[model samples]
Target: MRRDQSPFLLANPRRVHAAPWETREPDQAVTVVGDFDTALTEVELHGRWDPHLKASAAHVLRTCLVGQPAGIIADLHDLADPGGESAPLWCAAHTWGAHTPSLVPVVVCLPTAAPLAALITCRAARWNLPVYASLPEARAALRSRAPRTDRLTLHLAPDIDALPLVTQTIGEACAAWHMLTLHRTACAVLTELVANAIEHAGTRIDVAVTRRPSGLHLAVQDHDPRLPHLAGAVPGDPGDSERHGYGLRLVHTSVTAWGALPTRTGKIVWAVLTAKSAGERNRRRPSTIPGTTAPRRS
Candidate 1:
């Protein structure tokens, strides 16, 4: 992406590869990957029972399964967490298994991270999922299954003033394809992710939105160094009463992908939006409406 046009673009050295990238009408299949596919989809847990995290993980697995005719395989053997638990990753894996047409997901765990190594070891001991320590090894298991493709990574930040711009952009992108629901979802996910990043991550925080052919990406990075936890989340009292948390679950349903990143300072909570554009025309609306209450611009 060209940063000379925007400050946010500076942090990311992307080519925005679709040029003469004609601001041509949005097509459901414009960019290669939206967000999650852009990188290894990941989640970090401050607690063991995070429905939000679990639901988000399932969404990514489903995204990977789209347009494919085989099982979804992911590897977590190479992830940087050495002391975490596979139990945390199970939520995503199980969720993916339940919804998608596959029983297993290719999980790659990077053992370089001591915490991750321990986590994977324990999970492997408990389950039958194949665990690997390298990306290539993880890819090899799925290569013959599906033709791997391009990936894109974008950032989403909650902006009090950018809603209109975002709405217009998304509305234009999805309306052409009759994917109005996706537009509504983008609005909701952006609203919550941005709000959560700001309210929990603290000020000077900015929501970054990145788009690719496969999905839309959003993240909020803040200066605070503390890991964030929802104010009053409790483990499964085992009831249908939804887990009392923020709108993240809602976000999990709206987008095709989602995940979080840890920063040296504070953490960056991000989500990948997996939707396609087809040039559906429409008008602009509030960026932070309904499910979204704008977080103070960082």
Candidate 2:
């Protein structure tokens, strides 16, 4: 994949015409572009939002929400929904986001004059979806309502050297956020994730560390669609590859919860390390990993 000129573009390679977080239809009737600025993920919708675009748009929103961004700003200024038929979509999205363990905030942005503005306010009123006239206003409102989070991101090559860099970054983030207790586990989880990508994916990687109120969030994204799964190895047995299920096994034991999500270009393996009690951690685990089906070879 060729790199684009978007400032947000990192090591994770994407299509020449689209950013890693962007999705569009062939006819270009609708486009969903997501931008992650450490603190939040901004999803901008362009073109018509009629029935034809509803399914694609919902998928994009679900993908963004699954990544557990601290907050979301859904920009709909350019989306035309004259009849407000898309109001239900926004309502469902907000409901879904709120139900996440993190309770990720999802806000909408559109000019007051836009046809969808009044409809969203009236139809989505029960969901209490915040609607803003501008991005700045929406961002400010979300920042005020959402929990404060700190984040660090690094774009690295798929090499063994990236391990130390990722460890160093995680150490710094944990220290800076006063999460020294989680530093070791955080580093262990992140390094294993990056190392797995380096060995199997052999593509550029984007590593991100986010400090949330509950714990540390670590994610490693690579340009390979193959999802990681726990090898069906008997306990106390180190499978054939020497390091075979070792990395993911360590990650599974060290983190409170871990899973993978497919991206436009590849996949992101993420884990959360928390100091909470085991009971609380159990409550945080999702019934199933998002974007994951039965395990399969790449």
Candidate 3:
């Protein structure tokens, strides 16, 4: 870590967080602060924990609730766990519940199997905390919460040029969080998707962007009538000669929430960067492009 870097920043890559915490050190980095008006009291995720980055997110949550009894209202309604690895979730939830009596954790997960439910059953049984299936139900119980705000969506061509286009578009609109790493990540993802669309899906691509109260939304469309799956940022098929195959890995790694949506043509791959990350992504685009040998631009 640099003398100027925060100790809490990711020192090594953890399997938990995909690639958002990919780099050993980004040119610009921010300690994610959950904002209640201002990140005064909020959950801040640090480092990488695979399927979910919430592993260390309890830090800000605990800090925010210190001395103050008013707890936070967390929404885990849309959370997806593919690996069946619940350690991180259990760690984040159970540990937080134990530490903060003032900070109430609203468990908002979708209905799960009896086995899966068993994992979180302890939370409800012990804390008497309400576990809701949707955000609406959870919102009704919380005392301090705001109604969901409007969503801003952007749809565009999946042209190779789309990277610069979308980068500039998102950079300008979401100027509040101007982290260049976000743009770089977006640019990298766009490059891969558009390339895949052109090569495998028969070009004819589409992309959309939306800014919801919770985060910024991005959707890319194509006409090949095919579906894409999450793959390692580094391709396991070493024999593969595909160019930029690892793009989606970073896309998956960078945002808070992301996935693919079925479309009439192919599919729309989307991702969301939380509003909390605005300040982080907007910090500054790195002068030197990652992995390049050239010096940074002045």
Candidate 4:
């Protein structure tokens, strides 16, 4: 019989039997195995639990989640903590949740009916983290969620001249996704965002666009931690057309939704443009009309 040649079946094949890359210390070990099929970074932890254990796990997890994979499979079946404390485990979960661009879905595997399992379950409820008894089960959970594809990441200097190039890059993605109708609206939102980053922060900015089933999600990362909110400015008159404050206001009016989050290094401002019927954008009203308030960061 011919073996399956599907990449899904063969992802990261060379590393199938490879020893997991490990981070070791006197009291603990955290090993990570890449399972590319599900875009999961499989991590296994073993040893005593302590405040330091949490910090060590955070450090290791930062490395594992570098590319912002779809999800994480954390195996704690070998963990040797007898005290049944879940704080150290939750620390890693918190770090994974706090990641910018997007939070990583974490599926934790622990022994069935183990003391630690109960402890983790109790706290997991508060954070909505998933706990499973086996690796296969954890994989199933990740598989059930909708997949998001990373379309592109572009780094540009803080220059207004880059605006056209940025819009062109966005146009390409919109065309490929069959969302050509959104091109105009997307360009407007992106131009406003990029211009704001360059003017206020004056640092190199990174822009990432991801395609989702519902829409295209755009994120602009800057060195400034300060978040931007939609200004009260409205382009109801000629004077407002040239105002600097209209940038975010245009963002609020054009995109379906927008928000901001702080990263370890800086901050990421994100917006989503809902897929719309051809020419539907022309009929949409400004987001600040009448009783409506400007979009606020969630």
The most accurate candidate by TM-score is 2
Q: Each prediction's Cα lDDT score? A: 0.42, 0.65, 0.41, 0.61
| Candidate 4 residue lDDT tens string, 1-298 | 1122111110110111111222345647665554323445676777766666655566555544433546777788888766677545555565664563456776778886778777767776676667789999888888788365756778989887777777778878887888876767777777777878888888889887777555676777788766665345446776654564666656655665565544555566666677652135456653332211112211
lDDT string, candidate 3, 253-297, tens digits: 445545442333345555555534433433533332232121111
Rank list by TM-score: 2, 4, 3, 1
- Two-way lDDT contest, 1 vs 3, winner: 1
User: What is model 3's C-alpha RMSD?
Assistant: 13.9
* Regions of model 2 farther than 4 Å from truth: 1-67, 72-103, 107-119, 124-126, 130-148, 234-243, 277-298
Clashing pairs in 2: none
Q: TM-score, each model?
A: 0.37, 0.58, 0.38, 0.51
Candidate 3 is scored at a TM of: 0.38
Question: Candidate 1 — what's its lDDT?
Answer: 0.42
Preferred candidate (lDDT higher): 3 or 4: 4
Model 1 / residue 110 / CA error / Å: 8.7
Error of 3 at 202 (Å): 2.7
Stretches of candidate 4 above 4 Å error?
Answer: 1-150, 233-244, 277-280, 285-298
Error of 3 at 11 (Å): 24
RMSD to true structure for each model, in Å: 16.4, 9.5, 13.9, 15.2
* lDDT tens digits by residue: candidate 2, 148-201: 557789999988866777878877897788887676556666777887888899
